[model samples]
Target: MSSTELPESVAAAVDPRVSPVRVAEGETLRSVVLPGLTLAVRSRSATAEGAPPALYVHGLGGSSQNWSALMPLLADRVDGEAVDLPGFGDSPPPDDGDYSVTGHARAVIRLLDAGGRGPVHLFGNSLGGSVATCVAAARPDLVRTLTLVSPALPEIRVQRTAWPTALMAVPGMTGLLGRLSRDWTAEQRTRGILALCYGDPSLVSEEELGHAVREMERRLQLPYFWDAMTRSTRGIVNAYTLGGQHGLWRRAERVLAPTLLVYGGRDQLVAYRMARKASAAFRDSRLLTLPDAGHVAMMEYPREVARACRELIDDYDRS
Candidate 1:
């Protein structure tokens, strides 16, 4: 098997145009205009007032829809909202194309600050996971509980295979990326992308496929797709190399919110072994391992993941 056979855990890569963005009546997604960027946001229940609301953030190449399953479950008590980090989902790319992890974290923090809900229940996966951790640490006042699903923190054993995505962050790749695929079809992009993100490609339903295909087609039609991809790529890559400083370790140590660190033992992008270090970082935390799951456990096992989240919510309520 090619090293790039891409273990089944990564679903974002299956389709370049794929996004988790849709609207159900009464459900609305509003893009808040912020300095340097705009965020594609969807909200379910926003009236918690004094209760701790939930916030969801997706990883590389992911959109708000990725949390569709988990959001509905938590919406009742959590009053959750998920945002597409600029450049990946329906959200537009940054004005300066500055997609560093800190940059992304700032975007998240700004959104949370604007939400006006104090110290939310935070959930982040992969790249978003790293950003979420950073946000919680930097502004503990804004985060009550943190739930990280396979966060992309630095590891002693980084995947050499993941370097290609990082390379796109280089100065030259952004322009070249746009030129390389002028006439490429959306279906082609989606097929190539999905092949990389999903452990079991067959698990992707037809509707999901159509959504991705259309999203990619829509985004690629614009001139900003490459910019979004490259900038966000740079941000994600820079996050993996914090040089023993404010990386995941330090952030975890400073995070005051009760944390729940989760890992998919079968994940390819992020090695499950790092869970140990993660556990050590959080002063208040627990670990859950999904042996058969891939990169995105919530997507693969929504009910099980939901049950875990409910457990946390119950714990928070009691506190």
Candidate 2:
């Protein structure tokens, strides 16, 4: 789709009164209001006219900015937009307070339906991966191809490192953790997150760290921050317990789109061993394993991810 093809809702929803979030160079940030949810979308200008449309979804506690490094790289190939899921980034909480995987998927469907941007090259990372999986399975007509980076699919033996995140789903745990961490500085919180998500934290530059720290400071001040995190964590935990046809793995098997699965060897949240299982689950899927990267491989190695995504689209076109 051409850049001009973006719907009026995207242009109309921009509210100057809403506090601005950090947008990368060559990217524009806007709000897209659907019925019950208002999403913050970040768009990278397409390098070529008539490029295929693509949408990106960020992981838990993440925003559209997570795709900053990668979106520009693919601008020549796709008209890319990354969404800040409801209650995260600049968006407020959903009206229904439904943070389930299905709820998130529905929000995405609404955006695509409203914009008439179906059959998009859909991309997801971690929690967004789960959300993207559901979108693909439930609405194949809305997706052309799927690219998942360290998707948070169910694991038979949950990793010990991920226990703390899962525990937030328990009632009162979020409040307790909030109280305990209230004294912590945003810099401290940012550092902790970096340690958990990055394979090598040192690779993040001082400026990037500063940006993260500022974003952390912004999120910490939001009254619903902890609630959004806790409920979304619960959503993932709940998704894992689903069985038979409702399970994420089961849904993975149902997705008709050609898939590209990217796994990070050093990811602390999702197990690296599940890469092979994901490859087997998706009927027509390719796997990209970045042994040196962590959970956010798109951020760590955007060029590689972009190359693989390009190949995924090229292969599909050839087919």
Candidate 3:
């Protein structure tokens, strides 16, 4: 389908004032309630009638705000929408309390099916990346091209710095950490998160940091915050341990869409070494390596990420 064929609601752009990054100068936010999910969707207002539709999914603990920087850059090329998966962002916890990778993928599929936004350009970072892989694999009909940034694909030897997070899957670890860090302020927790998520924390500006701190504060206030984090962390660990058809790596091999995989040399969570394995797993793929980026390259180097995505879209069109 062409860019000008989108429905008015799908093509409508977001109001910039509500954007956390404010980088999405003309972006707007609207709440979408699908079958069992309620998502906070952000989209740019400048998209022309038929701009190709694209959807962004954030990582485990992240919200739709995570795509604030990248969405606007691609506004002219696609009708971009970033979703706050259930239990994250403004969306409430799932009544069923299933935070497995499959559960997340199901939520995404339900939304896409309901909106009839199949064969879209799908983007995901970290945990969201893993979920996107599942979506593209299970329902190739819904995906046109796939882009992954630091996907939480399995690694035999997980990184040392990521151990704490991976350990959250262990029974009682969540309560233990809560007791251990009870005295820590929100700012301290935010700083620690930035240190782990960003290759060079210094790259983030004061304004951005302030916005992030405030967001962290808001997230902490949610009643299901810790439950969601622990359950999702466990889900990722479970995905990593699977070895057959349900395994993430095996699923990655099933993805039929042309894929773009981005990795950061300084990523403390996902090993940069897995870049080659990922490239080999996806039948048709390209890899982009950023030596200075951490886990969130789309946010750290959005221009570069946006450029690569556009190139992928161009290549998909040509094919």
Candidate with best TM-score: 2
- For 120-166, candidate 2 gives per-residue lDDT tens digits of 99999999999999999999999999999999999999889999899
lDDT of 1: 0.76
Clashing pairs in 2: 119-142
Best by lDDT: 2
Could you tell which candidate, 1 or 2, scores higher by lDDT? 2
Model 3 scores a TM of 0.92
TM-score of each: 0.85, 0.94, 0.92
Best-first order by lDDT: 2, 3, 1
Candidate 3 worst ten-residue window by lDDT: 1-10
- Model 1 regions more than 4 Å off: 1-21, 24-26, 46-51, 174-184
lDDT of each: 0.76, 0.90, 0.85
- Residues forming the 10-long window of minimal summed lDDT in candidate 1: 1-10
RMSD of 1: 8.1
Query: Across residues 119-221, which tens digit of lDDT does each residue of candidate 3 receive?
Result: 7999999999999999999999999999999999999999999999998999999999999999988788989999999999999899888888877776666
